[model samples]
Target chain A: MTTTNLPAAATREALGPTLVRLQQNGANIVVVDADLGKSTSARTFRDAFPERFFTFGVAEQNMISAAGGLATLGHTVIASTFAVFAEHAFDQLRMSVAQPKLNVKVVASHGGVSTGEDGASAQSVEDYALFSSLVNFTVCVPADVVEAEAMVAAAVATPGPWYIRTGRPKIPVIYTDGPRFQVGKADMLREGTDVTIVACGLLVERSLRAAEALEASGISARVLNMGTIRPLDVAALEAAAKDTGAIVVAEEHLTHSGLGAMCAQAIAATTQPVPMEFVGVQSRYGESATWDEVLEIMGLTADGVEAAARKVVARKR
Target chain B: MVYGAQSGHIGGSMSSTEILAVLYGRIMRHDPKRPGWVERDRFIMSKGHCTPVQYATLAESGYFPVDELSTFRKKGTRLQGHSVLGKPEGVENSAGALGMGLSFGLGIRLGMRLSNIDAHVYVLMGDGEQDEGQVWEAAMAASHHRVDRLVAIIDRNGIQNDDFTAATMRTEPLDEKYRAFGWEVRAGIDGHNLEAVEEALAWARDVRGKPALVIFDTVKGKGVSFMENNPNFHGAAPSAEQFARAMEELA
Candidate 1:
């Protein structure tokens, strides 16, 4: 089906309210929070659906465990908290929730260094790797507000445990009016043969800009919005490898075991392996920086991605 | 069912047996055949070290055949030492970790509440497990949510893994503590007495505004003479001769 086009203006800041609306429409849905409902833009759900909304009073483990119970009872449970504390529920997410394939959505707000001011301790730079290590977790990092809302709706409706990494800042709109947000499929922005940039979360826009820069330098660059990190789109990765010969994975997480590592492993498991560069935070803690500074320091800026793409192209066969 | 077997947590297990029997026998609305029935009530063995009792009760309740009790704790046997999730049937979550089952029960209960399913979630925790911080977390959340459909039964045999509960970590006035946390507390019943167990459960069933905690003050190894109130048997399976003696006493 040709994707229906939505005006970008309508999608720019639609994530928070849209999620609230979708959840309101679904009777079986409940939102659990760990004292950050307002920051995560879920305060409306708490206010409107007082009975359906549960506040766990800053206890992430209890919140997740309760969500697991709610899921078993057949409720679509959405547990929202900052990304760092959500990691505190990793054991519950793995043992109680994912192992049983319980239908619960762990909506982690303030994901990545974009959280700012709270510094490294609060930022979940390693969340993707942590959740992806589990078997039955669907890790999603939506780049823009529209995708975040769409992904939230999809996550609540989807089966099994979902780890949705959302941000605190209002990101620019990318997919306005429903631009084909398939769970395991990659959103190809620009087709190229020389190099491909695989990215998710806040890095998608930077990757797109990096592609434009590469084109100016006479390089044909491909940009793939890799939303689902756990079930890494191997088919798309393989197609990019066969078509592009060079690839760069950009994420707002540590380079070790996040989307880059999953892509690396998937390509290694396949017969065809492309020259790849992983653009993300190196193994280090976060610091107090503006989103721009954090992106630049963590090598997630457009220039950083462009440089990484150049290296990949240089290493290509 | 396996009366002659040497087993651990016989005291705590016997104390909780009637509670389990009531749940599996009547209180819990679950189907052994379709264990994952969405509308079915959930039961979590929070104090999971007492598997001999759970296996025996499960067998008696026809979750599996009575013959399966013979393979308890043996390697490759479905009857594991702690309750595992992927077992034959009647097991919900893998709950070897202390202070975890209650939280898991809370999750299932919350899920049920969200789905608008009128199913209750029951979790049986050991008196010793009260020391775990997560238990308090779960208790606080359960009470805060006023989960009327959630019931937590503590096996208050006053024994721990190493010694008496007082010697290890006292969790006395357990009823008061849970009440302070917002659970409607009930006590003064013989845990082994089927009639009292049914009565306390009926009370818990009637609760609407708060979670219920039934503290079963039972004797460790109630039926067996030599092992009665013995902390050594908290985790020690008896030898063949000891097992025979215990079985004789129980019979």
Candidate 2:
């Protein structure tokens, strides 16, 4: 898909309108916010559906448990809060929502170091890892607003527990139109055979840019937007390893437990194992800075991905 | 069942037996034959460690065969160590971790209100479970929403796992605390007395525009002579000799 003229917007900005649409379409959807309706863009749903929206004041645990209760009664509940704050309700989410396979969509905003100026405490680089470890959880990190809206619809249509991590800042538009997003399916943005640049969330756009740069340098790079991390698309990873013989995984989360780890495991089990390079936060906390600055410090840029792609391609032989 | 399983919260279960009996027998509009009836009142046992009483009540109420009580805590059985929803027809929520039932009950009550279903949600909690911060969070929300269909009953057996609640962590002035949190508080009622339990629930049902709580004051192991007020029985199952003695005492 061509990226030119694609509309750029924050993932959080698409949450409210998308939820309203879901409710309008006869979905028994209820929106729950933990005093972050404005920040998480849940206020859009709150303003539209006053009766269906519930504001649990800074109480993420109670909000999550209540969401579970509401889900048990056959309500499709969307519980929103900052990604960092969602950690407070981990136990509740695990037992009440995940274990019971309740239909609760925990949409956490301000994911990763992109939540600039809030410092280390506000950044949630470990959310994907935390949620993916739970039983019966579908973990997603949409690359752009188009994917975000489609993912919200998909999450509602799909039953059971879901965890979606969205960024605070506006991300580059990767899809001109709403992409067909299926749980555990990867979107191949650009196809190549030299090396596959696998990425998710904010880093997907960076990987696309790196793929373009690699193309100019006479190196073909395949870009796979791995939106869903938990129910990971292992087939795509295996196909990439078989077709390209090398892989480079990138994410805004820590490299150890995020997409990189999942991709490594997938590749190791393939018929022909491939060499891989990881592009993510190297087991460290983010500081208070602009999103661009944090990206540069964490080596989460197109240049870093391009460099990793080159290194992995060299190790292929 | 506890003696048969050789593992259970016997003390807390004994203390809460009458409350469960009253709920499943005299109160709560529920049909044993139609356990999945849409308008049935929901019952959540927040202090889920005490499953023996709930299992007994469910059997006595005919929600399931009384013979199934023998499978409590056994492998591949619905009656696990803690309460699990859908495992038993009447078990509204799964609980083992303390201090989550009120929040879940509040959600059920709110859901019933939205669905236009006139049903009450009853949450049975342990006095020691109040120490968890999540309990107060749910309390504040229950009151803030004015969930009138919600009723929280605290089994104040005065003992925790290791010692008495007074010595472990002072949860005194609980009635004042609930009142401050905007709930209609009914405290100091004898949990063993069926008439008192019935009256408190009736009063709570009549309350409008606010949640209600009934604090039951009772001995830990009320029916058992040697187990009464004994912390050893808080989480231990009866031995062969002790089991015989208990059956005789209750008989």
Candidate 3:
């Protein structure tokens, strides 16, 4: 599939419109923000649906538990905050939302090092792992504005707990309008046979660039956007392992318990196990820098993904 | 039920028996046959460890068979050690961890008010459980939003797991603390007195435009003489001799 050349837009931009659209369509969507509505762009939803919006005033725990309560009353609840602050309310989310499988949508923004200049304290590289470990959660890291918008709509219509991680910086548009976004499905951005480069969130754009670079060097690299981290698309990973024989899993999260670990587990359980390489932060904290500078320093660039893809393919027996 | 379980929070359970009796028996508007009735007032036991009182109230209110009280914490029973939502009909929220009930109750009240559902949310929390920071967070939010039709009752038994709450975490001046957080505080009421508990409930319902809290000054084990204010029975089950005496005292 051809990539959309539209200008880069922050996932939060799409999130605002998506929430408004769902509310306009008569969805009983209530938004709760923990004083980060401006950053998470939940302010837009609050503006459109002021009556349905609530400001929890910097209390992430209260916001999450309140979301659970709203959900119990059959309201489609969207709780928004910075990803790092979400850790404060993990127990509340685990008990009130995940264990009970409440219909609460936690749309945490500023995921990973892309939250430039905030330093390690604000960056959330382990949120995906933390949320995915919950028993009944649909964890999604949207690849671009389009996918983020679609996933928010899908999450609202779908029941149970959901955690959709969006980034702070604006990333290139990877898909056209109305992408086919499912809860536990992976989107194949490109199909190939030599090697498969799997990625999610902002890294999907880098993976696409890496795939193009690999093709010029006579390597047929496939790109798969593993959006839903929990309830992973194991079938797609198995198919990729069977076909490509080598895989490179990339994400803007920690190497441990993130998408790489998830893919490794899936491949290990399969009959045909492929050589795999991980492209992510390797057990270190991030510092203040521009998004691109941090991505380069953390080895999360397209060159990094391309190098991992070649290394994995060379290790294929 | 506590005797049958052989292991339960009998102390705190007994302390809140009158409060539960007042709410489930006469105060709250609920239909036993229709536990999921939309118009029913939502009851969340935030201090979930003391679930024997809630289970007994639920059973007596006909949400489940009265005989099911024998299955408390037993295998193949809907009544677990802590109460869970949807396990037995009418249990609004699942809770074991402390300090979350008020927040959950605030959310339900906000949703009901926004949707024009016309319902009240009652959250039962323990005085010892006030140590959790999340409870204060919900308290601030509830008062900031001026969440009406939300009633928070604290089982202020003055004791926690190891020792007294004042020694454990100093949660005294609770009424002032709640008032400082903007809640309408009702303090120093006899929790064992059914009439006093009912009067407090009636007064809390009339105080509008903000959340109301009724702090019941209660004994840890109110009904039975041997267990009253005794920290040993906080989590300990009664033995045969103790159970016989406790049954006689309660009777």
Per-model TM against the reference:
0.89, 0.98, 0.98
* Candidates 1 onward: DockQ, in order: 0.60, 0.76, 0.83
What does candidate 2's lDDT look like per residue over A59-170, in tens digits?
Answer: 9999999999998888999999999999889989877888778999999999999988878998888888899899999999999988999999999899999999999898
lDDT, candidate 3, B198-227, per-residue tens = 999889877899899999999998878989
In candidate 2, the residue pairs with backbone N, CA or C atoms under 3 Å apart (3 or more residues apart, or in different chains) clash, namely none
TM-score of chain B of 3: 0.98
TM-score order, best first, reads 2, 3, 1
Best by DockQ: 3
- Model 3 pairs whose backbones collide: none
Model 2 chain A poorest ten-residue lDDT run: A1-10
lDDT tens digits by residue: candidate 3, A90-192: 9999889998899999998999999878788988989988998888999999998899998999899999899999998988887865587787899998999
lDDT (C-alpha, whole model) for all candidates: 0.80, 0.90, 0.90
Off by over 4 Å in 1: A1-16, A23-27, B1-11, B26-41, B71-80, B84-86, B107-119, B221-232
Q: What is the lDDT of residue B56 in candidate 2?
A: 88
Order of candidate numbers by lDDT, starting with the best: 3, 2, 1
lDDT of 2 by residue, B1-251 (tens): 98889998999998998898888888899998998898998899999898898988888998899999999999889999998888788888889999888888888888888889889989999999989899999999998887897999999999999999899999889999999999999999999999998998888877889999999998899988999999888999989999999999999
Cα lDDT of candidate 1 equals 0.80
